[model samples]
Target: MAITFSDLHTEKGIKSLDQFLSGKTYISGDQLTKDDVNVYAAVVEKPGDSFPNAAKWYHAVTSRLAPSFPGNAQGVRFGGKAEAAPAKAAATADDDDDLDLFGDETEEDKKAAEEREAAKKSTKKKESGKSSVLLDVKPWDDETDMKKLEEAVRSVEMPGLLWGACKLVPVGYGIKKLQIMMTIVDDLVSVDTLIEERLTVEPCNEYIQSCDIVAFNKI
Candidate 1:
C-alpha cells in the first residue's frame, strides 16, 4: 500500500489525505500503526509543499516521537518560533568564554605583530615609490647605431635609476626604437634629470633624432 500510494505521484492523490486526516488523528483507523509510519516516510520523500498533508502529518508524528532528541529532523521546522533573545545572548557569551580559554596576547606577541605590520607597510611604500618608463629612441637615417644607443641609455648613472632590460626594436620606415625598462626610486625629480642628460649628451644625441617617453607605469 505504501509503495502503491507513493507511486501515485499526483498532487490530488497526496492532498487527498488532508481531508481524510482532517477529522482523524492517525492515518490508520484512529491510533498510530506501522501503516502511519510507512505512509509518512513515503510522503516526505516527495515535494514537501505539494504534499502539505504529508508534511503536516510527518511533523506531527516526528515531534511526538522525538520531542526530547538533541537534533530535529532535517528540512522539518517546528512551532515556527526562533530562539529567545536572552538565550541567543547567552549562547554568544558561552562562545566568547570558550574562545577566552586561549588567554591574552603577551607583550612580546604584541610587539612582534606591530613589527610585522610596520615591515609590511614599509615594503609597500618602497614598491610604490618605484616607477617604469618606456622610451622611443630613433636614429638619424636608416643606419642603426646600436653601440651609441646602448651607451646613451647607460650613460646617465643615477642612484634612483635601476636599469633592468634595454633593447633596440626595429619599427617600420627604417627607424629602430630603443625600449628601456628601469626601476627608479621615490625621487621623480632626480629621475627626470637623469633622462634629460641621457638624451642631450653627445654620443647618444648625435645618432638619435628625438627621444620621448611613450608609456609610464608604477610597479
Candidate 2:
C-alpha cells in the first residue's frame, strides 16, 4: 500500500511517518532516492524521541544527502492533502546476453556484488550513529536583530552538521527566542563544543546571549 503523511511539521504527520517507517530502511525501496529526499525536505524538524522509526529514517536520509543536498529546488504545491510520491523506477542495464543457468558466473561479477553489499551495510551502520538536536537560542535583548542572529548561527558550518528549520518563539515581555533544529554525526559534532566554542562566542555571541538544548535524540 502507498504510504501517506499529513503536514509533516505537525505531530499527527510525524506519527504517520513513524508508523509507516517501522521496520523499513527506505521509504520506497531498498536504497535511497528522490522519494526519500522529498519527504525529508517536508519534515521541518527531527522527529521527537517518541517516534524512533522516523528519527532513524530522518538521520539516515540526512547523512546520505548532506554533501550535495538539493537546496535550490522550487518545490511543487499540492492543493489538498499531499500524498507521498512513488519513487521512480531505476534504469535497468541493457545487457542483451541471455542467462546461462548451467554456467558459473564470472569471479569479477561475484566480487562486484560483494562490494555493493558491503557498501550498503556500511551506510546503514553510519546512519544509526547519528543524532538530532533542537536548540533554543536566546538573544541579548529584544533589540537584537533575529535575522542577523540566525545568519550568524548558520555561518558556523561543519562537516557533519546539517541545519534544519527554525522559527522565532515568544518568550515573554515582547522577547523572542530562536528555536532551531539540526542533525549531526555523533563522532563529528559535539553539541557542547558547538555552543561553547562557536555559538555563544565571538560574533555569534553578539546577537545570541545564550543557547540551550531543548531535545537530543539518537537516530
Candidate 3:
C-alpha cells in the first residue's frame, strides 16, 4: 500500500487533521524507549509491512525534527544505572582465615567472585528504578474554573506551569487554531519550540473539547 497526504485515510486522521495540525497519533500499550517509540511511530504510520522503510523515514525525520541528541528526549530512563558504584566486597574475616590466597578455595578469589555478584545486583536496581510518566490535565474555563484547576494541581502535589494542557478534540482541525497550547514549565528539550510549531495551525472545531497537559517532575 502507498501513503501520501491523501492516503492517511482513517476517520480519526481526517477529523484530527481538520481540528489539529500534524494529526499523528503514537499509540502503544506499554511504555517504550525514545528510540523504540520513534521506531514504533514510523512503523505505525507506514502503509503496510514496509517497516524498514518506515524506520528509515522515522530516523530521518526525527533527526531533523527532534531537538536533543539521539534518544535523549524520548527514551526509557533508569536511575543510577550507569556510574553506580559496586557494593562492598563480602567481608570474609568471619570465614576461615587460614584459606590459601591462590587455590580454588582461597579467600582472595572468593572475595572477587562476591564482588562481581554485588556489582550486578547494584546495577540491576539502578536500571529498574526508573519512574513512569503521569499525565494530568487542566482546562480553560472561568475564574472559578482556574481556582478549581489550581486546587486540583495542589491536590496532586504538582507544581505550577511544569505540566501541559491538552484537549480531547472531536473536530477535524489541526495546525491552525492550536487547541492545545502546551506552555513550558521547564527548560526541557524541544518542548517549547515544538509547542510553538504545533500552534502554527488553527484550533477550530464545531464540537471541540480541550484540556491542558503538562509534564511535572514526578517526585
TM-score of each: 0.38, 0.44, 0.21
Candidate 3 residue runs with Cα over 4 Å from true position: 1-111, 128-144, 154-219
Q: Order of candidates by TM-score, top first?
A: 2, 1, 3
- Ranked candidates (lDDT, high to low): 2, 1, 3
The per-model lDDT (C-alpha) reads 0.57, 0.75, 0.31
Which candidate has the top score in lDDT? 2
lDDT of 3 by residue, 1-219 (tens): 112233233444433223322223322212212332323232223223333333333344333333433343121122512111110011121133332212345464578689989999988755542222233332432222433333343232122233334333332232111233323323232433332333121231111223233432422
lDDT of 1 by residue, 1-219 (tens): 222354324567667766566656667555544445445444533336655656666566554434333364432223542222222222233242242212466565588789989999988867656678777767777775767776767776666777778777888787677777777776553555655666656756776776777777876
- CA deviation > 4 Å runs, candidate 1: 1-128, 188-191
User: lDDT by residue for model 2 over 6-108, one digit each (tens)?
Assistant: 6897998989999889998779755664457568657766677999999888777655544332431122123433223211111111123232222465675
Name the weakest run of 10 consecutive residues (lDDT summed) in model 2.
Answer: 86-95
In model 2, the runs with Cα more than 4 Å from the true position are 1-128
The model with the greater lDDT, 1 or 3, is 1
Any residue pairs clashing in model 1, and if so which?
none
- Please give me the total number of clashing residue pairs in predicted model 2: 0
